[model samples]
Target: MAGFLSSWPWENLGKYKYLLCGPVVAKVLYSRMEEGTFKEDWCFHISILFAVRVFHHLFWSSFSNMLFLMPDRRINHQGYDFKQIDKEWDWDNFLILQALIASMACCLFPTFLESIPLWSTKGLVTVMILHVAISEPLYYWVHRCLHRNKYLFTHHHSVKHCSPVLHPFTAANVTFLESLLVTAIIGIPILGSCVMGYGARSAIYGYVLVFDFLRCLGHCNVEIVPHQPFQTLPFLRYLISTPTYHELHHKEMDTNFCLFMPLYDAAWKTLNSKSWELHKKIRSSAGKEERVPVPDFVFLAHMVDISAAMHAPFVWRTYASFPYTMRVLALLGWPITFVITMMMWAWANTFLISCYNLRTKLFETWAVPRLGFQYFLPFAKEGINHHIEDAILRADQLGVKVISLAALNKNEALNGGGTLFVDKHRDLKVRVVHGNTLTAAVILHEIPTDVKEVFLTGATSKLGRAIALYLCRRRVRVLMLTLSTERFQKIQKEAPQDCQNYLVQVTKYQAARNCKTWIVGKWITPREQSWAPPGAHFHQFVVPPILPFRRDCTYGDLAAMRLPDDAQGLGSCEYTMDRGVVHACHAGGVVHLLEGWTHHEVGAIDVDRIDLVWNAAMKHGLKPVSSSVTEQQES
Candidate 1:
């Protein structure tokens, strides 16, 4: 807990510096509104100022999106998927809607705070108190009613819910009616403040700006705010809504209806069920590398697109990039070109093309900020060369030395455990890693020493096979689960004689439920249907597993992996209290950074070199968080 506050590891100071733009632009508008400045029409002045506010809000929202850095879900769990709303139109629509609302408020509302007054301390305190007193119940019921009415929700309220994975712009995506209700709740209070002669324009603007920032933060996917205040003081949590508080609301929709304060939600018994556990995890994970800023490293990833057709971004970019004469010719010949391209691709494809920029930014985590850029590529199983080509170009664009392939990217690039892509892309200036080696290494490092036997799922898959071989070498008997008996037999025959017979095939996950350690290397269909034994550890390696793991079993994946004592094995990476050992894929990137290249063959998964890699991480300032998994893997 002490370590959480000892240092703040945010690295992307470039974005927050935009906050200054708000006030600077506001001052310019305020001067124009005064007697001697350009046209003393208060209405006109206020209208422009409203536009400025809308622009400022949009700027901040876009800035946050561009600097897509946040606490890794492995450290602090996140509810939103960053990739879902990456289209440029989504942002433009949000900004346009909010700007329209802001214009109305500035032009039509008679209660605009026009006069700047010296703040009296007592008056400020009174305003804060009155704000909650006036806004809470009004907002609470309005929010609840919006949800209760099917017509209102379907037509207006649901637009905001379109982004179940919340972002800053999500806070502004509400319908005009909902926005008006919010405005009225806020307006009446400021109108009263003016009637009492206590309204100071500076104080009002300050409060509004603060509210805007908090609202943006509440929707941010990252959870960095500490829950210590709620834990130590007890009453503070009810008063202030954390990002996780609102996130649970988006996730469940029935609970947590508070605007900024959680007081009403607490009193009404609408707080989320998982809020406490989630908050504890949030506060304790502050020191994770995801929360810190690593200047040199940036993670670029994409969700696996399983579609057969090439994504439209490539077509759009190609058409827009042509010279005027070529553009006209292409437009005239578009039907033929489209048909030819599709037919050729259907037969054989060579290059991957970009579909959209899902997230592009410098990420700030506990250690330092890394350049994090993510894009969507439609070529998941087909068009292998195109995918690899775009990856190289994107990495080069960011000047990143290494690029981590995620989901289908890993699947296609590695040929499901082969290094053909690396061999083919030998001329790429940057290193490409499948990121499976470190993940496998971390899972191997975390297995309990006392466990004599383990259950291995996805036994025929690339990752599963590697784990089976590694476990066999360690003399730990493995009960392997695979759909293909022939593949398992082939792997078994390759094992050392002493452990060859130790490997046994299991047909069902339920059959292996009693095994003490279950390594889920790939998704088994109808997953999470059979639960692991009560005390067993379930290590999940696949992303978006076929189904969520059963809740009762211990989550022994990277989110819970800890470091060894005294940071002996961790290299130069920074440590966190709750989340100790970072994800092995992340740690692998750090290892490459320290060594200046991919020392091992890229795209291959192995656990034999776990110690060397772990030591490399520790030497570079990485430390272990958990004392239990500290022992070196036995030879």
Candidate 2:
């Protein structure tokens, strides 16, 4: 899907070649059991075969159609503005028609393979060439005629032209007549070639794969084809059909009608000028070079290198630790208590350093820094709160619409599970968010549908309790770990009797037996790896994971957010704490800002609004990990 061959001409080949051609190459070596490479069953029915084909198309098309909703996996880097896909969900009738048309092709092609042999390399190549040779001119003329004819244009062809922008799914969005016409154009040529004894079964499949691949590519709106060859070697300009080339045909409505190859368009003098220029602009060795505008929900971040902060210089260490020692001495009535009190007063009365701008883009963020030791120090609470408030006020002054309090900032500001600070400061222009709703949502979404046996640590916490209830409702067996049996009983008693059967109460991690999926809440900070199950997939809610993942175990943080089309932008960029995107709590504030931008009531978002943030996150390239672990490598 990244790139193909290494040579100058072939290196430009994209996923189309791999997706369309690789299968043909594989099939040639090991022909299927039905192709007489193995025992043939006389009981095999053609209707069953046709039904299989229909179901195959239905399943794959449904899955591929949903891929548009995920930005990271998208073929095109440009994000879709309108949620046309949500509208496309009602296209069940169109899918049926598509399946019928594909099934009909299956019947004509390999099902009638008495005379035709399995396609060799030459046979497959010949079929593809003939298909392009025969179909292109006829398709061009017919398609142009449909556009020129007012009645047909308005009723049939215009259905496709209605979408000025094209997408992979958009290739299937055509009227019934248009779909039939396209199938006929493609089918007639390949079937004719097979009858002439120049084609094989492999060729038909290759043609089908190529047909879908090209249509999908033509509509992808992303111009992946390099312009260097066309620019340097002028004669090669007419050899290929680029995304920009087809897009021009959509925009202008009277040119570049050739499919796959641009030779016919050049001959007919219908090649678009704008497409040539666009190709030149994006013709670098790396393809696209432009930096997209930073998304509105940009993550505001700061470094929290625990190891570095803990080992600060002597003066800074003394500055941080002195207050705690003096407080202890004052409590104990140690000598020089008066002097210690005065020093403590001086420390408390010191002016705040204040948070300031660290990064800028669609949203700006002011970073607040503190040594890791400061969080545990006696003077830390007041200082941390002051910094958080300062950051919020600074963000508001700087015109930041929303500010997400990341990590301990959330802890200090919210006081470990209350919204009093944000609630009290209602008059501020900047909206503050903890971004936990979607974090919980992301974790819940990652739990597999087939998951039955589950282990949840810190089940007494808000997030753990919510997840336990959710899993119980799904009737999945849940092992809930808490500090005591009393809290476990409290949760168990809260559930309906019907759900009680699926709930297991425990006070220790070792009691969680045979559960493959482990949801470790913020409260359960297991220092040793053996505390978790062998080969377990750990979902850590904290930024720096509480448990060090075992060699066999997979781990991820709660910071999973996506960007547009997995575009080479902010989300994928390497950062200090984690290499990829920041935590969801950081991005959560961005999501809240985006919610407000869309005119939704936005403030401190709750778990109920997860869908809104989740949907918006995907649109902007927030990739959803199947499990709640944000820090796992995408395999």
Candidate 3:
């Protein structure tokens, strides 16, 4: 989605030339994937992985969804917000896992002569069975102790419960030391028994190998491993464990200890079907709490590299540990930054050469083309996205006229429902150049005549500064306005050009984010709600109180339209032929309107604190679209 190509004339015929760079991009990305888990060629791999996982589930076990609350894998009763220990009641099975790993390693390594080898198939099978026997009973007892003895807290069995809510990958995080101890205890005796040709048989060795892989597959954090590994054969049911069965064991630690079967837990009457219900409830709550704020991973990646670089340059040692993950990332990240930054520098240079004051207009317009929202582009830059997404939401909610102030290389003016195009004014005196089809969007919208002239080309905060200056000089009523860098720049620039003498007086007055709003606030921020200019009572036109809400505020209100009892049925008798501008207002703002023409929405302004108009001068520099500026500049 970030791979957006702007729809513009000059943007073509460049290094970013979309056609020729595919092979080069592919090679660079593929090479990075070979080095580590962070694969640059992830688009295809992730899709393949997802497909494999889904297929595994269809042919696998019988769980409806992976997030099914079960005792074994997840220990659903535990707190979902915090990590809980795994309850390995089936110690024998876990021991079997350790034994299998160690036995295979020992067999592979000849240097470990002191280690007895389950080198033969028969020997391997004998050792494996023995391991299953010894660990199984011990675990059953320990498992009982965990619940029966209050002294043994859950943490002791922590590793067992890791993926309380299991997917396929949850099987690997077992504690190393705990696994080692189990391996040593089970392995030595098995090897000793395998004296001479007493090592494990080939069949048994194969079983061990398959068993290890299945154990991991069964306890995965995802349900991609299929519902049942041994499908269509009841006899081979024990071959690959299902998440449902194993997950129950972890969660219901007091039960399911005997290996290769749930028969033990059932015969012993330790497993309860009702516990499944509790498991569901717990994980459900956890899923709710899973709403994590999206982190700025891009920024985080940069910091990691910068820190590693700083430390390495300071302390040099003879033996260098592997480069920090951050350092490696920095090396990769710098190239991307350089490529992007250099591209920006080039664009700025080229644009300046092509057009001077019009550069900003072209650049902005080139990003979001006029009326392009009619056919949604899924790929767009983050900045343009924020505006478009919000715009889309507003458009679909309440059809609107989206007037964009950009210089497209086409006809000077264009118009569409929910779309409008504004070019730099060739004749500044008119302030607005109405085309054959273009409706007055920005320059002609609900803004006052004098303010519209004042706000000509500025962006958001610049418009606000312009308004402040004009109001101060003309001694006009001022209302609320937004504060920020744009406001600062506009005041700095427009004040000298327009409001010089009253500059000192204007400097005494400042705009801030603290504005009061209970109206059309969906598109704005908290600061806009809070720091509104002092006394010009800032009330939000949260006019969109209902779902079909179009523009954060409705331009009209039904409550205000109720006619008085004396003025009933004017349509017939006398047809109280009245019509200039019918404005029905309440204490807050506009409620309804009946006139030859109606304006935007019902928003009350004290007219005391408001300035003349916004000076959007800083929009050229991407300063925020000030709240007032956003309100004022429609087209």
Candidate 4:
């Protein structure tokens, strides 16, 4: 029976499992449509209860992520992986069942049908007393029993225990049987208050909210509550459970079995002795010496579009878990993201987006709260640079070894490929890297060694110029597509005298009609792509990759590389790249830190260092993605 009740009926429904709530939704709609029904109908109450609980859960989820951004406050240094995220994805299913039970109770009980007052002092007192006398003791004993009984532990309690590192969602990551027992434990206090004729709407709402809030707080994995409170009133440690206390339970089971209160654990002598000491240590580390460990490397990035903003970890965890792709449903979030974008423009600063560990080093990604289009706005340039500069300064102050500027943050027209800050703050100890040296390396290495000629677009840009010069030196004929003769000649002169003849100037796409190799640095229309001959492959560094017009021609993704096997705790994908893969620029920064290079890699790419950077990246176990020439056969 326990095994049968362990899993939810809709567990196999996948994303469509929300359809299970159709009946309650229809009930609410029916009640609203009936003109004779009161505004506060039972169905309306159920709907409101469900919505409020969901909102409460989301609040904790988001708030905990905010705390997670501050690494010093984290209790467990070890991070969670995608499997744990998948396991906890359906944590809210139990809430749906609870709502259905509420609807059933409202239908069956005549006493529950009576109009309840907003607030009742007697009801509040009764709930507190019942919770202390009934819920806590019952849960404590049942919880202990679940651990002691092999069958219960294996079939029921083990679900929650699977996640050693807890997140806010872990609070509800339990089997259906355990969820039912939890519901009953929570229901006793409220139902008891009603039986005593002291129940009120406020008491019900307040108790449920407090219960959920504490559960989430305990599992949040960050030690938020200070040790000062317990220091002043030592008994408070037994009255309220902290994140560190609960963490100890997950770490060393068979102890700290009390729910919300350690008082019961104390009475049973089940509380771990190190709980208080560990909590104090975490608090003291964050408070007294202020020893927040600095990240070894930082990849500073910005949003590409509204859809990209939705992929932020805090915004939508499930959406971010998979590789990002433009979807029709993503358009629905435009209004919400637009408002957030505007608000960020006015008030926000640089913030941590995600992080991971590679061997002994810690790497973090930080975001400037601006979208891609904003980088081109003339008025926004100063503000964007200011944010970028601030982030660089913060990284330097924190003793970061390498900080890489990504995407538009390294635009030549804006901050001169991060040169502005490096030149202005010459005394800065942190090495500022544009990381375009490896960007050019990744793009250059994608061209087949046998291909004698390649047509290039955005021919005069930073990456474009570097590729042109490098290819010319290889004696590979380059069709540089640009009308600016002076700019074309400038790049041509940078090559060795003998190879200068290989850099051919072209003004139109018609020149590349016969060339089977097309390097696209600029966005091209379908008309431009039509000029490419059949079987031509387009190697690109363009942001928001161009549309594939010809069926015969293949297009490559932006330059990226897969991290080494030693990389750990990478739970989310990087933009549209697959899991464990990162943009070439991000990989460049990691290689810079690992190589212990002290020079700031900003401004123009040194054609000399292109092979050096590529070789160094390979030496460090960073594998090029399939889009690179080395992996072309597999791709």
Q: Taking the tens digit of each residue's C-alpha lDDT, what string does model 2 give over 52-162?
A: 543444434433323212322223343222234332322233434444454444445544555566656767766766766778878877887887887777776665665
Worst 10 residues of 4 by lDDT: 61-70
Question: 410 in model 4: Cα distance from truth in Å?
Answer: 1.3
The number of the candidate with the highest TM-score is 4
lDDT of 2: 0.55
Candidate 3 lDDT by residue in tens digits, 1-635 = 11112122223354343333244335446656776543333223323333443334322222322222222333322121112112221222333344335434544653543333324555665665655565444545555654565433333334456544553324433444434543454455345545544653343334444444455555543323332323445444333334455666676665655444443455577754643344344334343423211110000001112233222211211001222234453565466555544464344311100000111111001122212332233353333333433433332232222212221111112222113211222211111111111111111223333531121111222223333454445643333223344554545455435444343321211232232222222234434333333332222212222243223332212111122222211111000111111111210111111111122211112232222111111221211112343455553
For residue 200, model 4's alpha carbon misses the true position, in angstroms, by: 2.9
How well does candidate 2 score on lDDT at residue 207?
Answer: 68
lDDT value for model 4: 0.87
TM per prediction: 0.44, 0.44, 0.33, 0.93
Total clashing pairs in model 3: 85
Which structure among the candidates has the greatest lDDT?
4
Candidate 1 per-residue lDDT over residues 168-249, each given as its tens digit: 6678655545665666776665556766877765555566666677887787656657777777898887777777887788
- Each model's lDDT: 0.55, 0.55, 0.31, 0.87
TM-score of 4: 0.93
Ranking by lDDT: 4, 1, 2, 3
Q: What is the per-residue lDDT of model 4 for residues 547-592, given as tens digits with 9 covering 90 to 100?
A: 9999999988899989999887677789999888999999999999
Q: How close is candidate 2 to the true structure, as a TM-score?
A: 0.44
